[model samples]
Target chain A: MSQKEDLSLFVREALLAGRPRPEIAEVLVVAGWSQGEVDEALSAWAETPFAVPVPRPRTVVSARDFFVYALTFVALGIAAFHVVWLGFLVVEMLWPDSDGANYWQAREARNSIAAILVAAPLYAWLTVRERRRLAADPGLYRSAIRKWTTYVTLLIAALVFVIDLIVALASFLNGELTGVFVAKVVIVAVVSGVLFAFYLRDTDRG
Target chain B: MNRVLFALMGLIGVVAVGTGLFVFGGPGTARAEREDQDRLMAVNDLARAISCAYDTAVLPEAIGVTSFSDACRPTNLRVSASQLMAGGLLTYRRLSDHRFQICVIVHDLGRSLNSAPYSDMTAGPEGAACLTRDMQG
Candidate 1:
């Protein structure tokens, strides 16, 4: 049918016929396929001594996987953001600024706490459930959606670090070294650092 | 490790919520705050109506059941009857023909409402706060 399908078929036939992978790769490369394409075609099947070539497991595209991972990450984001917000509120309350104990600030703390109460439990439940599933079917590690979501989270965490540094340096230059400001900066750094570390390790495992 | 992290996060959430309640009080405090805000808005509306009426006529001794007067009645004023009956008597007193003061009893919910006309109001300890204004006619 398609050129790539034809290539995969040829590679499978060549492997079953006992043609070595490197020779097949070289033959395809000489026949004008890129080295990557030739390598990919060869690597699609396992290199085992058997009558027929065995196909390596490919990344699954499942709607259920997408839904679970989407909900898990959304909950994680909500919980993380509000935790940082609550930390900032706590800092502000402890170190009184000139304009102290605002009604709005108290209201905001209440709202943040409410969000954390809901989101944190949801995230924990989803993660535990997913972990159980992953244990049963370790092939779920090959989920393309899971990998993409993890990378997106890592990217956001990296951006938060860059922005935090920029703001910290800017505040230092501007002489805004108040206890509240410093504490808030530290809160952001600690939370984001934890997230980045956890997800980075998670991606490695996946 | 994952389980530990999840438990820790959940614990943090609970702790933060507890701290929030400790510092800011609970749902009752929130409800009181909302009631106080509504009281402020109602008082503010009454004041604005009095100021408007003072442009043409003398300030009314008391706000009417619905309207201050046909010309200066506040449109869509949301002051509740219970709020009005409870303490929002909005004691109106005239300093002069063009100057007046309106006082309303408000609960001091530790709200930092220090801005504009509210800033001018002299808030007493857990009682009536009054705002005196001159008509800019």
Candidate 2:
């Protein structure tokens, strides 16, 4: 059993033995468990007075869910890379002196364009598929993995947003706020903002 | 679900068309760019070879050239197609005693022509060329 399972079992046994909840919590805390863990463990058995509660079955992810989620993750990664690459291309096109286009840049721009072409469509398809599935069965929206993935995407978007802000601020402070820098900052902001807004709205709707 | 599938199908169609265009249209531009890069490298190499001959106190004829002044011409030098010296695509001429010009037909103009000793030239479609001073002096 995992440490959490062991802790839950210990908490259940202590509660059944009529030990005071405070004492159980204190002992667990002294045994290196955090107060938060002790409180959570205690709360799991809080209302069970006489009858032993049946353990809830663990949620099993279906193949379809796995496939969609995996595909979405891969698409999101590709989208992020391509978005940054496209930003660089735009910057180079605008400011050729500071950010000149060379053979490698041309090659990268072509590859990134191809990647975005593929990944953006795939991402849209998976997102629409998941949204439709959730609409048909609202309960599916509560799936742990789905929620986790959405939250993780939100986290990444937030991080990118903050990083873009810092980059823009640094560029401004350095007096390097050329058209290229401004364009790059705008691209990053727009992309991350759209991702943040979409996920935030989805999470809220859920 | 049907709507979702239809949208996905539509997206797939768009991607297919985009990929087809890229596959077909990308290579021609790529090949031209590669050729331009090769031409730039060849010009620099020729300049270096001339400088080497002058430094070693050897005649340009020793390196399969008639003379240093006229050696800039494509027919006078031996270089491979990979160096953009094939089919007389590149031309060279000694403008004066201390200056020489290398000319090439480049399709793309957005790239920097910052190759040393010839960085001042602007890329153009008509014919992008750079003049450099003979470094041998």
Candidate 3:
């Protein structure tokens, strides 16, 4: 409420978010306060701690926390699906069709499967590590973890899908591909687009 | 008891969502699939048509070199002619007497997903599709 309180809040936020001290001056400037005013305000707040009693430890997770839970499960889902899909790809490649239509098709499918087989699990691990890191923080303990992991995973997944979609669409748009390739592109777009949409929507709303 | 009830409710919600996905195929699935079938079949027909369009009446089926053309690689044109609507725009290339290239390609969304399963397409001439889509890296 007071200038001192505002300065303390600013310091707390900046420190918590790991911003450099030099940037605090910029932050103060942006907030339309002079450096002297901000420093004085912060000093006062630091000198006088809040007099309220300690609050109860959190038991029930906030919606953001629950979002982490949901997203973790969703990651598992994606990992599982891709794992199976990768297996199918391996099978197709090992026993590729003898009499040939698309020679490179089988090979491509095989490599694609292998790519997901490696990336999905690695991404999932990074996410879990971040989740654990957040479990200790008082305020952003759980949230920071979930958000970081979700953001990273979402970005990687989106990039992967978008690139793949472009590749798939190339054939049909160019008219060099057959109707079936077009159909495959359509299926991929529909399926992955739905997942991408859900990820984005939840990220925004949460 | 409350926790148990919450768990039960959550379970019900999960089941409902799962059922909806299964029964309805979610949002644009059916529509996408309807359009996709033409694209998917194009792969099949492209291979078949290419084999047929050979200057020689030789169907590659007699030999062992024909599978569905569902991979997206070196793709340039994807026109949907009335003829392709019924059959397909399959073509063949004879590099030499014994060593020739018999292939077909159909463009579709699934084929577009060149990350894991489709990325393999970029390994060959079909990789042209990959080049077009992912020129950055």
Candidate 4:
């Protein structure tokens, strides 16, 4: 049995020996027993395993579905970015390169929109992945803080990618839709791509 | 107990339907073909809208945007998927009839290509909010 299960069994036996719950809790803690172990053990004994049917396996989102959904968001985003960039270029060519109020307002709106869509989807992915992981192995995911932190970190990378996007967009908005502009976007894409691929595989195992 | 089972059964049903479409459906079945047509029509419409910005054998406003499969919206709306697409997309747009902007919309941000700063941009991988209006809606 695992540490938690073993401790739970011990605690259950001790409590049945006429020890009060609080006393058992204290004794378990004093004996360097983790709170999780104590809680698990107590709860398991409190409810008869036979009385409560086992939790059947749940089929969460499949890997293929996840991948397809992910691909669409990425493609649309890239397509939209290029569209706006070209829009700015045409506008800039027609009108002089002037840092006017209308331009700034439009720019801000674009950035804000990008952040909303990008961040929202990343967050959604994080939540779905989290649920999947939690269901897959409760013990590993027992550390609530760790689970949350990892999710937050994934969002952070997404945030960075969005920030880079804004910078690239700003460049285009300012009429920099040139070779150098495309090159920078390429670089950012590569870096974030590697980071995203690596983080997902590593976080689940840990 | 019944409730739990019902919930599980419901989940299984939805998943079953989704899988069936992906597996048993013929290569470009009616549904897939229709979707493709929709996406293509949208893309062609977009391209036709701003063809004045591009110089070539000015192909008539083809309806390529009408060809996107139903799978496009949900899939393209995810961050990880967008990240992948950033590397493979290429398109052109005209700033005006006089000037053209050919941007390689990568998966980084969701702003314009000109020189204006989109400080309020919520740029990210899961969206094509700004660039999607091009040769495809």
Where model 4 places Cα greater than 4 Å from the true spot, the runs are: A12-19, A35-150, A157-206, B1-137
What tens-digit string does per-residue lDDT give for candidate 1 at B27-58? Answer: 88877666655666666776787777677666
Give the worst 10-residue stretch by lDDT in candidate 1 chain B.
Answer: B108-117
- Listed per model in order, the count of residue pairs whose N, CA or C atoms clash below 3 Å is 0, 0, 52, 75
Error of 4 at B114 (Å): 14
Q: Which stretches of model 1 miss by more than 4 angstroms?
A: A98-107, B56-67, B80-89, B95-97, B112-122, B127-129
Candidate topping TM-score? 1
Index of the highest-lDDT prediction: 1
Which candidate ranks first by DockQ, i.e. highest? 1
What C-alpha lDDT do the candidate models reach, one value each?
A: 0.75, 0.65, 0.43, 0.43
Assess chain B of each prediction and give its TM-score: 0.71, 0.51, 0.34, 0.23
Each model's TM-score?
Answer: 0.86, 0.66, 0.30, 0.24
Candidate 4, residue A9: how far the Cα is off, in Å: 2.9
Sorted on DockQ, best first, the list reads 1, 2, 3, 4
TM-score for chain A, prediction 1: 0.88
Model 4 complex DockQ against the native:
0.02
The better-scoring model by DockQ among 2 and 3 is 2
Write model 4 residue lDDT over A148-202, tens digit each, in one string: 4445546655776788788888988998776645655654554454344434554
